[model samples]
Each structure stands twice: as structure tokens, then as C-alpha cells.
Target: MAGTGPQVARSPLELLNNQAAAEPPLLVKHAGPVIFSVVGFIAAAGANWATRRPLLSGVHRYVLIVGGSMAAGIYVEKKRAEHLATRDAMFRHYIELHPEDFPPYERKQFKDLFQEWIPIR
Candidate 1:
């Protein structure tokens, strides 16, 4: 919504009240892990309070925040990678089985005008 179109940017009133596209910044694997870390932080805080281990004030808190964020992000990334690999393999198999259906791919006549037109630049 913030960076959608020029109309929003052009309006002085809307521009003044616009919020950033990304909240909490893009520090850890985009903004996804940040949300996961928040949930983990809450759970860890509750556990820490209940146990009363008598450790440093916030040492465990900070550690859990980072560790939880990484754990969630890595798990999700791994799952996505596996799904993509499976889908790619299926497509390759289909292409091999029906080569006649898919004709030879021809290169576009003018791939990009800038490369040929603007040789000096």
C-alpha cells in the first residue's frame, strides 16, 4: 500500500501519513522471522519466569529471540526448497515424455534494444 502507485505519493496529505512497507526492518530473513521471534520471545519469557533459574537478567531472553527466529526461518526455507525441487523434477519428466507437444524454443529477434542501440553506453 505504501509504495503502490504515484497517485498516493503525489497526494501531499496521504504522503504525510504513509507508513513504511516493512515493519521491524529486514534484519532477519525478511520480516517473517521477526514475527516468529516475537512469539518465541513471549514463550521464553514465560518459561524463564516460571523456572527462576537465577541466571543473568536478560541473557536468556536475547539468546532465545535470536535462536527462535533462526530456527523458524530455516525450517520454512527448507520446506520451500524441497517443494520447488519436487515441482521442477515433475516438469522435466513431462517435457521429456512429450517433446513433440512443446516445440523448440526460438530466441526473440530483439531481446533488448538497449544492448544493440546503446553500444557506447
Candidate 2:
């Protein structure tokens, strides 16, 4: 006997698979390695010069030391700013709810409870 029910439609997953199969490969697949190779060469050259011995023996050493320290200091400052922003956002929410100081013990308790629900690393 012929089928009694209506024909079922294709699900979204099937339609998506068909669409994906029709498209060309990603641009990055063809261009990524070429870009990476060029960048790697540039980075290697820069590192080599930054580390190489100088006409004056101590000059190269001093430059490398100062440059590295400055880079590290900038990176640390950026990270500290990001961390403070995150901490402030977390505390701002609490201050909005309670104007008075939240005790250290209570703050810890709240932090632990909140983190347990939605952990942040």
C-alpha cells in the first residue's frame, strides 16, 4: 500500500551539510602557510640581530637586556590592567547590591560560591 502520512522534510543539519559541501575551501587553507613562513623568517632575522655580538661587546648585551626588560614591563602592565578590570567588574556588581563594606570572610565566601557556579580561572 502507498504511504498514508505526509513526506518528512530534511532537517537543518542535513541542509547545513549540503551547503558546506558546496562551498570552496577556506582562504586560510591556501594562504596560511605562505604567510606563516614569511613571518617566521622575519622573526628569526630580528631575533638573530637582537642576540648577535656587537662591534662593542657590552653594547649588544646592554641593548638586549634593556629591550627585553622594557618589553616584559609593558606586557606585565597590560596584564595587570586586564586583571584589575576583571576584579573591578566582579566587585562593582556586589557594591551595587550592598553599599557597606563586605567583610573579607563574606567576600571570600561569596567569591567561592559564585565561582563554584561559574568558575573563572
Measured by TM-score, the strongest candidate is 1
Over 1-121, each residue of candidate 1 has an lDDT whose tens digit, in order, gives 6756643332222233435334454564454566666777766677767789543457767586768776897687778769977876677667667767766544455665346455565
- TM-score of every candidate relative to the true structure: 0.44, 0.34
**lDDT score, residue 66, model 2?**
50
After best superposition, candidate 2 residue 89: deviation in angstroms? 0.7
Which parts of model 2 have CA positions greater than 4 angstroms off?
A: 1-57, 98-121
lDDT of 2 at 88: 67
Clashes of 1: 0
What TM-score does candidate 2 reach? 0.34
lDDT of each: 0.62, 0.51
Off by over 4 Å in 1: 1-57, 111-121
